[model samples]
Target: MKAQPIHTIRLILIPFTLEITKTLMAGDTSILQQLGLQLTPYWPDQEAIDTFPKIIHNLEKVPEPNGFESYMVVHRHSMTVIGDAGFKGLPNTEGEVDLGYAIITQAQKNGYGLEVAQGLVNWAFQQTNVKAVTARCLLANVASARVLERLGMQQVSSDAELIRWKLPKPVTQATIK
Candidate 1:
């Protein structure tokens, strides 16, 4: 299956290829430059860099267009990779898919997180059997919570440390016969 890049007003969510993941895991910069992404300061937060190897492993099991793979959030104007985002995997039997994202320190506060999440959530809903998208953020992450809220996700659960949000598939009106 072909992996199609999801586009937003200012970002392009390109699925991470296995080769790219491996290269990243190995601390290689050539691939980034090869992809025309900015080098040097190009870096996601520690969390994303640490979790990517595991993401690659999981993607190996399910493969693209079916598995839960991460996407490189490319800034359209700068042509630089500003972050990463995507679902945890295919939707569960209940048709719920978990989503996550992180913007680089330099790229934060530019509304990239919201744009990326909105694009991914919309893409997920367009897929077969996807009924809802879910996300959670640390209680300290007010920005992330705001992004979810702006995306129209409802708070379903919360604790001292985290808040969970969900967005159900939008209802479409059918024409009368």
Candidate 2:
């Protein structure tokens, strides 16, 4: 089954399907119209554009969107595509999935990163097979590191160029009747 859109108070995470990925790569904004989404002129910035092919590759791996691939980050009230976020793929043998997100420059510093990351992390942990969510950011990207830290992800490792983070599933206690 296709994964459904994930809704948060101020944003909606719409999973990228093959059609959407192709349309995006082709520089066609008509898909946005069809989906009732608005696009900012600054969106699909170089970084976001560069990730399209990878997103398409991931989408092709499954018959449909499995919620483990990329998603368009749409602003709730404006219905605008402000960014993109999601996992690299389904959970690994270790039950861990890698997370990634990028907000358009115009939408930066507004907490959208944290909001979307929280939503994505929460969604991943809800899956029976997901035991941990992982992410990596450039060592120089302080803002991105802040978002991961805000989500309670701990620094698992770091190299000269990148810092890796991990958030283990939060344990929950069963309620007694």
Candidate 3:
């Protein structure tokens, strides 16, 4: 069966040179504090790693990371780096990939995450091989889960603290006839 296009957001291809750009320019880290994500285990060495370097390093190497194709979420209006959304893992044996994202505190509840999530999924589908997209969120993270559902993903199951969601194989273009 042929794959289909199944998402509803516009996507742009940004080079790693942009997101991973490193310079002496002062950067804002307030988004971290605002989102309450600054201390997450994801960034375990908060002190030694340093904020700027961490982001640069993450951007620089994320595409080839063990399980992610990270991209920086930037505001088209203000042009500030807002948050991040990306595919979290390679296509599994079943041909599905995991999706994940986060928004700086101030950026939350404003529809950015939703747009980026949709856009990312749209872009993934354009890769022309992905059968589906899966997202796992903390059970208590209603907001995150809502992003997936609002994009038409359905709750598949849960394990412990994680809520798993799925976007079924897209309706193929051939099927549209």
Candidate 2's C-alpha lDDT? Answer: 0.92
In order, the Cα lDDT scores of the candidates are 0.84, 0.92, 0.59
Clashing pairs in 2: none
Q: Encode model 2's per-residue lDDT on 22-102: one tens digit a residue.
A: 988899878898999886687778888899999999988899998999999999999989999999998999999999999
Best by lDDT: 2
| Clashes (N, CA, C under 3 Å) per candidate | 0, 0, 2
Say which prediction, candidate 2 or candidate 3, comes out ahead on lDDT. Answer: 2
Better candidate by TM-score, 2 or 3:
2
Model 2: CA > 4 A from native = 174-177
Candidate of highest TM-score? 2
Model 3 segments beyond 4 Å from truth?
Answer: 1-68, 175-177
Model 1 error, position 59 (Å): 0.8
- Cα-based TM-score, every candidate: 0.92, 0.96, 0.65
